[model samples]
Target: MKIIDVICSKGRTGFFFDDQRAIKQGAVSDGAAYIGKTATAGFSAVRQAGEAISVMLLLEDGQLAYGDCAAVQYSGAGGRDPLFLADDFIPVIEQYIKPQLIGTEVANFRALAHQIESIEVDGKRLHTAIRYGVTQAALDAVAKASKRLMCEVIADEYGTEVSDREIPIFTQSGDNRYENSDKMIMKGAQVLPHALINNVKTKLGENGEKLAEYVAWLRDRILKLRLSQDYTPVLHIDVYGTIGAAFGNDNYTAMADYLESLAELAKPFRLRIEGPMDVEDREKQMLALKELTRIIDERGIGVELVADEWCNTLEDIKYFADNKAGHMVQIKTPDLGGVNNIAEAVLYCKQKGIGAYQGGTCNETDRSAQVCVQIAMATQPDQILAKPGMGVDEGYMIVYNEMQRILAIRRAKANQ
Candidate 1:
């Protein structure tokens, strides 16, 4: 279909409780560099820091065709306090993107994406964000034209079929240092069919005192569900030093023993641990990781080492492969660049005979999620991390349901 018009919407959304600090930190990073020094200085300084969401729409034959929402932090240069609100991005979408996309064919997704990327902000490329908008627009169009649910379109396009049996969606959770993990797990539970809850570090608050008790509770809950039969139910744990630090220096040995105990208890439930190594202490982290891996290996338990902050780019992936850092590589799209970049990383991991998990993101919507799923399927990864809507006000439930539908359709076609 030919693109006729583009419509872009900009608004504010609520932030996830745990993500506030991270979002503020990101805003500060941008604010330090861009606020007062650039043309957007005045605009950026007055803006309030909150959840930013953008919606763009593509039309078949109109001046107002494409639309999508961009939700992220905006900063004022010089480390200013007043951050840019979501609304600050609307004018840019209207002034720069609207005119360019008008009268273009909807099917020329790549060309349109490139055109959007060509638009620059503050002498740096905004291609990543622009491509995100284009993908949203294309998915919106496909959903409308096919007269199918967003999930159905995704399934049809990717050749994956979704089954009614619950699918286990894993996410991490904890407090203080592990707060982000907690929010991610709770959000994942809300969005996916079945949640493989990751009880992260237990060295914080009175909560730490009840770590063992809570794990037992969680274990019992899973057993009651009997999720292992129909769904891939696996509990994951992240063994970063932060957890050890919370409990004090002497707690490191104790924590390792606790993990061994937890693993033994989790054996019957088929629980897997995903240890994301902290790169800060390279030597120590590697040694601890090896010990953990060996323990799991001896017990014939599955363990995946997710390189989060440790592996951000292609070179990082290579390093992990070279050193045999972990059993599984976690692929985060934005950090790796575009879809193509992530695909290459997956290929590299596959060649090394390592499993891959399409990592979660805070900035993905329906469109971005589908693209992630497509990449995951194409790579044939063992597990795909499901982020869904996460903190987005759009609600992850809707986004995930749509994804399941699309995955179902894609699997059906692939088999046929």
Candidate 2:
């Protein structure tokens, strides 16, 4: 029942690495380069796989389990980094956290995780990536000790029921180009397209007209594809809120106006706009967005504003839900401390009646994506994001196939 070993390893996400935005921008000139903090003069290396830290635990009984550590390239505002979460991961685990729990009972790992999260390497809270990894390894140990699925362990931890039905998968468009979206639709997939207006604004100034044209094209293509399919996928766009920057005034009103236009562009398709404004401070963010919601509601704007950015932890998720700040909150998987905290956030959002989109960075690894699908299906969130990479087909296949296996296991147990 005691954790005997903690193993942390570094690998690539099999996707080109980018700092903040989903492969939308921040890509090197080639769109496949992996550049670190210091860009080399005239030559950026093409990393075969983006950097990722995967944590696995070996128990006394020889069972092993893993957790996904999706450390985003950019951790702060405007994609600030000379830093990556992978840098601190090994030191934090081997030097700081490993010694504390090598002999601790797996049953007490939840409290162990709480202690690990509170530890500061010199005046900094443990990175969310480290929290996710350590806690996931710990939870996996507990599940193995009890001979139960990690999702079942999570439900029992939170005193909630795991929904028995299959969870739906949502895929992201491979790139910002509207035509690329049709490929996934042709393959019978639901897609998430990042408008990446923030990137367009940074590189090509005040390009709202261009972005809107792309959206119009996407709407048309999706409608044409839907004529043949039974499932009408939602048109979910994550604008890093650069649309707000497109206006001369650069305020809430300008953002709201642009959003209304986008809403009109997405006629009759269920539309949700994630991150319309990218402010880092939570209180100010909620206050400002609450005002935007008021404006949208009063004017009857069709788009829904989703909160991301600073809404990282379980507390942040709960706060947004309690205040009714955004119509929905993007429950970024890495933000919640690990599986247990993630389950709590999802169930809390469900209880509070706020729409929770179980989402994460595209920089994640495949194992983490599979781990996420299990928890999402177990908890039954409103939607789940495709992960590990931005390639719509690859990410969708990994998540979708994992969900099918989970369904089969659940059905077999029911018959038994």
How would you encode candidate 2's per-residue C-alpha lDDT over 1-416 as one tens digit per residue?
88778888876764644444333335444554534442322123323345667878777888886775665434443322223445556776788777776777878545756766777778877667777767777776777888877667766766666667656566775454455477667766654565444455443247577767777887788778765746566777766656554563237677778878878988766678777665646787777667777788778888887877678778988988888878888888876755567777888899998888888777777887777876786678888877767667678888888888877777789899
Global Cα lDDT for candidate 2: 0.68
List TM-score per model, in order: 0.61, 0.87
For residues 1-416, could you state the per-residue lDDT of candidate 1 as single tens digits?
A: 65565555554333221222232233222422322222333442323333434545645533232333333322222121233334555576677766766665654333444465567767864434444445555545555655554434444544544333333344433222133334434444421222222223323222243444545655555445443444334665443333344444234345445556655665554444444333344445545555555554565554344554445555666666556666766665544433445556776887887766666444344545555654454455555555443332243444356556656775677699
lDDT of each: 0.46, 0.68
Off by over 4 Å in 1: 12-50, 62-85, 92-119, 127-131, 138-168, 171-210, 227-232, 238-241, 244-258, 272-302, 310-323, 333-348, 362-380, 385-396, 407-416
Model 1 quality (TM-score): 0.61
Q: CA shift at 172, candidate 2, in angstroms?
A: 1.9
Clashes of each: 45, 1
Kindly report the root-mean-square deviation of model 1 from the true structure over all alpha carbons: 8.2
Model 1 weakest 10-residue run by lDDT: 190-199
Candidate 2 regions exceeding 4 Å error are 16-30, 34-49, 78-82, 85-88, 174-176, 201-207, 227-229, 248-253
RMSD of every candidate to native, in Å, equals: 8.2, 3.8
